[model samples]
Target: MAKIIEAFVDERGHLHTSPASAIVADIAAILGRVGDEGGLTSGVAALILEKRDAIEKAFADYDMLKSSGATIIDVSDRLRFQSHAE
Candidate 1:
């Protein structure tokens, strides 16, 4: 079966003190219940695998942008545009 690999977050969020293994165990339990409810575990796995590359790439791009010192301006623009669009 496919596995969820690493997780990445931007440097600003509050750090959770939970162990990584605990998080993985929680996800496994959730997926097990989802399967019991007629959700296809294999389908979920396949979809995640398919999109994994794009997801990782997007995160990496965001990290690069933050490292370049542009996140504040980027976030401001995003909020302004979203507010106007709404």
Candidate 2:
């Protein structure tokens, strides 16, 4: 779960906080419920493991763009263009 967080310090030396999205919160809540009952189901664990690389890549991309000073609008525009192009 900590891996989902991608906090960083900016050039000004101020730390930026990464808040979990609603989707993440929902997933965590569901997982917590299942954990309380017992523990992670094999399927759930396998799914999380399968998605780990993609999740890590997303965090890496976000951190890279943030460190490069790219705004959300910039990423949105690029993604929009790529979607249209495809």
Candidate 3:
């Protein structure tokens, strides 16, 4: 059987390898090429396109919470407190 992998981002804005390491590698290569051409913004745009499904799913989860009466302020405050604690 083939192993499944996952992809995640670490603190350094680079990808951490997992099952989705191939996808991450592709994004990194594109980013590197764009960066070499002094196009960081375009590189990020490319990355967003590559990870659109994951990003959309995350946003959908957030939207569900909002529909449940959670405010953006509430989420922001919690994140701020967690950041400080970290």
Question: Using lDDT as the measure, which candidate wins?
Answer: 3
After superposition on all C-alphas, the RMSD of every candidate to the true structure, in Å, is 12.9, 14.8, 13.1
Kindly list the per-residue Cα lDDT of model 3 for residues 1-86, writing each as its tens digit.
Answer: 98876657633555566524445455555566555565574457556767889999999999899899965666658878788788
For candidate 2, which ten residues in a row score worst on lDDT?
A: 18-27
Model 3 alpha-carbon drift over 4 Å, by segment: 1-38, 71-76, 79-86
TM-score of each: 0.36, 0.34, 0.40
Q: List the residue pairs that clash in candidate 1.
A: none
On TM-score, the leading prediction is 3
Error of 2 at 5 (Å): 34
lDDT against the true structure, per candidate, is: 0.57, 0.58, 0.65
Q: Candidate 2 or 3, higher lDDT?
A: 3
Tell me which of candidates 2 and 3 scores higher on TM-score.
3
| Residues 11-76, model 2: lDDT tens digits | 344445632233333344455545546455434644665597998899999999889986566665
Alpha-carbon runs more than 4 Å astray in model 2: 1-45, 74-86
